[model samples]
Target: MPSASRIAILGAGALGQQMAQHLRQQGRRVAGFFDDTCPSATTAEGRVLGPLAAVATEFAAGRFDELLLGIGYRHMARRQQVFDELRADGIPFGQFIHPSAFVDASVQLGPGVFISPGCVLDLNVTLAANVLLYTGCLVAHDTFIGAHSLLAPGVRLAGQVAVGERCFLGIGTTVIDSLALGADVRTGGGSVVTRNLPEPGTYVGVPARRLR
Candidate 1:
């Protein structure tokens, strides 16, 4: 277990509240929320925290050291905007991994990442900032997942694979060993990537190929 830290969540959606509940249950202090629109006092799962905007002053005061972005959208442009704004404002973000996820000691995860339940990260897997690993995903040894990527449920990356920035691996997709997925790529559900994908496009089907 890590030391207790003061944290704030940016969104009040399902993912945001789930993270808050998980962290609170782990004995970490959740300071407040910073939603664009005000969130209800009780979240979907009935986790009660105060008003969402209470952290505005805290953000300006430099009191909170960590922040989490809980929006579930896969739009890289919007995500990058938020990241750039936060970076300009100088709030350091921290990665959130569920206690049940199995991560090897050799793995290095970047800030503002979310690793959900039943996930396994093998040795030396490097995940860049703001990446999301959905439930039951498996990333094998020596894989590099770039910044702002999202691995949907049941996605698997074999050893030595390299995924570029802002990529999305759909549910049940599998990437074979030593393959390189280019930047801004998207793999459809149940696709099998056997060759290197060098261009950015939506790929689907076995031995994945770009559709457009």
Candidate 2:
């Protein structure tokens, strides 16, 4: 069993609180939260640490070695900003995979990645930093998920699929084998990607055509 370590979860939203609960269950101590604006005194979590600007300083001062990003906003731009800031700060992010997840031994996961419950990752799958795989999603063999991408619940990626940086695959979406997605692309819920996507925009529907 891995010993408990000190960790700080950024963003005190619903996801953050849920992450805190899970980490605590794993015997990791959560040292409050780091948020720009403090919520109510009595929050889902006890207290907020401080503003976002203070994050790097706090991390450098040895406040926490690991950071879990729990903010689940839809906008990809905002997500990029947060990711970049964290990297610039030089704080190593922690990857959180639920105890129930089935990750293959050959799979490579980067820091700050989060895999929710019941997710299945096959052999030789590589997930870059800050990627999020929601519950029940499956990444097949030889798949590469780039940095800052989010795979929603039940999203399925076939073998040799290459998802670019900052992409968002909505709930129940499925990508056929060997397909590729460009950076900053967003797919609608239940979309089926049958071809390679190059331009960045909102994609929707079965067969997964671009909407924007």
Candidate 3:
């Protein structure tokens, strides 16, 4: 279990607000949000605490013990940058598993993982740190999702699939069994990945083909 029961969200966008609600429903306290755009403002979830610049100070003052990076897939680089900065500042990250999600006991999960509502992770699945599985996503048995990968809503990974770091599977994308996708791969919405994608690039279509 994580040491902190309270979490401070790092973004105040739609996903951030949704995460706040989910965390609250899980019985964890939502300290507030840290967003530059909405500094000192009130959100539907809670108050916008301040900009990212205030993180180290607030953390040192014990305002919140853990952080959830609520930035979306479009800003993957920013997410990684902020995570690195906070990690270097000795700020801990928290994992948020929605109450409706199903994760097998044998599954291995790393720090800062977020599994959204109705998502399922099968037995022996391994999700590395900061992996994000949005609503209704399914990761089958023995699958491996690398660090900072994002699986959009309803994305499905068949058994034994391996998704590399910083990959993004768009909404409703499906990857068949035993496939492997290299780092930084991006699949368009509703695409079906039928084979191993060893190179990093954007893909789309019924049988996913590199677009760029």
Candidate maximizing TM-score:
3
Q: Say which candidate scores most in lDDT.
A: 3
- Candidate 2 lDDT trough over 10 residues, lowest sum: 37-46
lDDT of 1 by residue, 61-179 (tens): 76566887776645676676686677666778877788889999999989898898889999999999899898899999999999888898999999999999889899999999999
In angstroms, the error of model 1 at 135 is: 1.4
Model 3 residue 92 CA deviation (Å) reads 0.9
Better of 1 and 3 by lDDT: 3
| Model 3: how far residue 118 lies from native, Å | 0.9
Candidate lDDT scores, in order, read 0.82, 0.84, 0.91
Per-residue alpha-carbon lDDT of model 3 for 1-212, expressed as tens digits? 32346799999999899888888877788999999998999999999989999999999899998998899898887877888889888999988788788999999988789899999999899999888898999999999999888999999999999999889999999999999999999999999999999999999999999995
A best-first ranking of the candidates according to their TM-score comes to: 3, 2, 1
TM-score of each: 0.86, 0.92, 0.95
Candidate 2 has an lDDT of 0.84
Please, what's the RMSD in Å of model 1?
2.9
